[model samples]
Target chain A: MKSRDLFKKEHSDEQSYVVIHPLDDQPEQKKDLSNFEPMKMTFTVRLSLIILRVYLISMILLLAYHFLNLTGIIKL
Target chain B: MEEKSNKIPDRVDQPSTVIRTRYRWMQKIMLFLVVFGPGLIVMEADNDAGAVSTYTQAGAQYGLHMLWVLLLLLPITYFSQEMVARLGIATGKGHATMIYRRFGKWWGRFSVFDLQLLNFLTLVTEFAGINLATSQMKLSPDITVPLVAVGTIIMVLTASYRRWESITVFLCLLDIAWIIYAIRLGFSFEKITPAAISFFPSGQGITSSYIFLVIAVVGTTIAPWQLFFQQSCVADKRLRFSDLGYARLDTMIGAIFTIIVAGCMMIVGYMAVHSAIGYVYKNPAQMATSLGAYFGTIVKSGLLLLICNASILGITAVSLSSAWAYAEVMNWPTGLELKPKQAIGFYLIYILGVLAAAGLVLIPKAPLQLIIMTVQVLAGIMLPSSMIFLQLLLNDRELLGNEFVNRPWNNWINWTIIIGLFALSIILAVQVVLPQLFSS
Candidate 1:
């Protein structure tokens, strides 16, 4: 008997049956996506990265300044 | 070789193969039902506890003059979510995994770190909302918080992806109560007709406080956790390329539904403002209390129930986003379809997040207001950066190929939206830090 058929027969019931298709025989356990090449940082990509850093830094500084003022550590 | 079975399974649990339908419309409908859950849940879940507070507050303070903001956000919300769904369908990977791979280690780690931190803080707010809502009903947080925490954990651990999605979708549909409650509170098309298109303030003229409120509405509408949640959800569902059209429709429907629910919450606020009682409450629960005193217990209980529902939905989606993102980056087994043992790290993260947030809410004197402030600031920092990555990924033909890559027009609209979001983020940050600067 075919393995799929035998496995199905064992799990089958009066109301429902498990369909073990070829695709379901060995389900993917875990994915290792480390092998794919990272995107090349072209000038546009590089510039976007630079812009992101600047944006993040400025936001954090603004937050720090606000905290200082809130705590009365800074008058201005 | 065994002949391949041509039977399509309708329900997730039932393993029956049915004959293909003759009618094309029938087939299309079937296909749509299969692709429905993620988009609707994410969008409805967006109207979580914090959203209830923000939208209700907007209506109470400004009336329906701010309805145009929600209308403007409809297209923005749909377009941004459509891209995230497209990426998930195309790449079969979570957002965190995509960032880790495409952006290299430093940026990837930074994105994940920021996402986890913000999501954790947001989860705390969800629990706090739960506590507030339940307290209105004389239910102590000591009992309600732990009960809710355990319930959230059990829902995920015991069910398959399909069953869990069904339960979440049911909760999403329960938002219909908002519309019904608004009607009971005297909402009508006649009242909203003027506010729908009016772009100016009514009660208060455009001040720093007005701008601050506007920014809050925008920030609430388009959150950073949403991107992580929907993408991971799409990937977990294993949607095919053919399902993309249905997924987009699903997202559009979700966006519309969320806006309506949000608008109804605002109506509740608007009614309170117009009422003899007036609008003097701090949060949704308080608003419910004051309104309840006038409108009766039904209104109060209805609002509290809606809050608990929203918080539960938020708790599920937010914690799932954190777990899925963390697992994807760590390359652990992920997906709600897997048994708990098979996805130990993923399930553990979800449980830990719920417990930690609920536990904090239970602490007598925990600075939850401070945490909420920090969440707003971090969300301000996080949203723009996440969008930049999303835009970059969608543009990368090398990653998504021509079929999935953003067209020229898409680039134009998306970039404009991202810049607008960045501006709003800056406004949000400044508002958080220097309240006096934006003080009326």
Candidate 2:
């Protein structure tokens, strides 16, 4: 069978799929997996990323808010 | 049967295996070549017109005391970009789409908004550079600015990914003229060695002006648009996990080449500072002015060429990032594969970005200097949040298989970089606001 057909048959998901030609030199072990689903994160880890995101966004917003106030666009 | 065997050539022997192996190697090489442009282009594009100014300002204003900063950032640049490659290859999604999927709409929209705002402002700085360059050669902004905008529009509308990338890569290669011109103006390795190794700010570097310049340098090297641009480019190019190592190699080579070019830019200004005709610089253009005076018009043309190409390159990348990020967030069809007619929203966003920036640059007395510096500061403010998303996504084992995930030690190093950049951004914001709050 053609390698492209083999690729389609072995892994058909739209995420990611490697088209490993028959004669390529990559190792038999340690395949670079593609088409991966997001691994579920623990609550604590998820909260940390969320917190960092909120804090940084707030900082930028505060800066913007200050500019608006200085320009008398709104009184807060 | 004899005739068929003769035509087959490998019918009697074990040559089929060897032929297939060689053919396979050739195929792999070809694939690598085709996938090579995005990483290198994105990284080199970081050293765009704004970067040329920032690095030149850093060297001219503070000399080699800041050389070590470039050395320090080499790894940070590599680690940061490698995450984008990993995400693009594994999840097969653009950064915006991935953020929307993995996080939520709020964070995703925020990213898109931040990118387009900062990206448009950055494009203005790029056209300003083009205008400055072209005018040095007696070409008016009325002529050059609209010409560049039209050219940029045509480039994105090419609709063929490979053709567009080949054009970008060719421009990226021409950027090396900055270093070559520096050599012609009298760059000596012996003069560079001692200063290159200096590890901290010295002389006039302890002032607020120096501190602000340092942050600008960092911002120039590790801007937020890169994260979005590379991820989208990878998705558009259809890069799979097998291309991961090759992409990282391409990223590394690009980082090294750009840093070397940045270093040469610093040398160009530093030579003038130490020359018998030494004087303080009033603007980034002075680096060219001094070199032009000493070495003649060739130096000016060389500098102008680098500036114009760098600006044009930045326009392509920055505009595409805006288009791709916005389209992905809106769930609209977006890719270079789609004809301009097929992907109207995508092409529209790209065209509007260039046109708006071109219009802003044409405004008389528009304070281009402040606009440029403000965008850098704004990008610095926005970087940590984007990076937070990128890091979490990178470590998510499901998103990238365990084999491709960041290890524990990698997290430690990554966190350190995040904190350092976060701190620099705050300092930069303060300096821009107060100007002399901490200056000596």
Candidate 3:
């Protein structure tokens, strides 16, 4: 009876190990919620944005000068 | 004893088992073949007739002085274009698509409008150039028009992507005719030192006429359409991030080819036209005729044919590029892959552009020369804005990611082009405004 009980206990322990091992091996599954956050506009990005703006302004001014000259409005 | 048994078993298995390789040699060959299209196409297209005419005129009028300018423009072209390739890979979208997404609808609308107008104007020039060349062979515009139109339509429509690319590259190879003409012009291999060290201004006066040509050379070399076209092409081809190195190599090869062709063209003009004991023709066709008079009828006719080929091919390429950009911006069907019916609206615009330009040429009293000059001036005016947009796009981290942003060296080079172009625009504006200012 004692031997039979020990065998039963060992089998139960092995079964439990089998069940828990898979649970442990399976990584925690969490959806990456960080992507759900709105895109943040940082300082470097804003600075780059400003550079583009400046470039546009300069181009506009230069174009205006060309048109004025072509139309004989500006006597440069 | 147990360790020895385990090692013996492992060694025996290793000796018996085969090692599998992940990458095949054939895969490398296929990748190379696929990557081969854009670089050769772009470079060959640069040797188109209008570009040839520009280079010829530059060399004939300025001699070897402006040859240095071509050398200078090389790096600018490579740097600007490589950025486009990166953008394409990073975004998986054309330049126009990215512009729409990042800048909103207003800017998107503006860019489409500008590109379409320019594309139309350029198409007209291309037809004009074709007609001009065919006319030299005594082929009437009537015959030439239908023939060229049908031929181009069939070629683009019937051919698959790989075939279309190959055919275009083959046509581009005919641009080597320029090199042949250069050789005939008697450019000594030993004369490199003299050509390199030569410093003749060759300008009759310190006038704005001279300055305008300088600017024109720069403007023509780094046209705005090239930037949009190249990046979008790279994106369309689905080049991966790893292929960036190969793409950069492609662009460098293209720039080098452009410079070599431009250099040879200048030498041809200098040796043949500038040194000849006769008046130089004002136009490229006229120059060809004069070259025929001096060299041989065969050489002359050959050059003219090559010029026409360049113009026609260039127009077709640029028109298709514009159409692609427009279609992408509006979220319509795009690419040469789409059937004509499916992409009707897209191709209709392109076909209509060709027809309108051809029709304009058929008119009795069209000022073709003025039309050409207007195209150049318009291109000049629009250049600064194009540069501005390109610079913005290059610096955008969200668009390019951290890995692809312009390095300091890249930024410096691009800005130099911008500054140089701006200064030229200013000078040209001044020159036009006060025609008599520098007449003395």
- Which number leads on lDDT? 1
Q: Can you list the residue pairs that collide in candidate 3?
A: none
Q: How many backbone clashes does candidate 3 have?
A: 0
Could you list the iRMS of every candidate? Answer: 9.7, 14.8, 21.0
| Candidate 3 DockQ, CA atoms | 0.03
State the lDDT of candidate 2 residue by residue for B163-192, as single tens digits: 788899999888778777666767666665
Of candidate 3 chain B, the 10-residue stretch with the lowest lDDT total is B1-10
Model 1: chain B TM-score vs. truth? 0.95
lDDT of 3 at B320: 64
Ranking by TM-score: 1, 2, 3
- Cα lDDT for residue A76, model 2? 45
Better of 2 and 3 by TM-score: 2
True contacts kept of 3: 0.00
> Model 1 Cα displacement at B345 (Å)?
0.3
- Over B350-402, each residue of candidate 1 has an lDDT whose tens digit, in order, gives 99999999999999999998998999999999999999999999998777777
Number of clashes recorded per candidate = 0, 2, 0
Candidate number with greatest DockQ? 1
Using TM-score, give the best candidate's number. 1
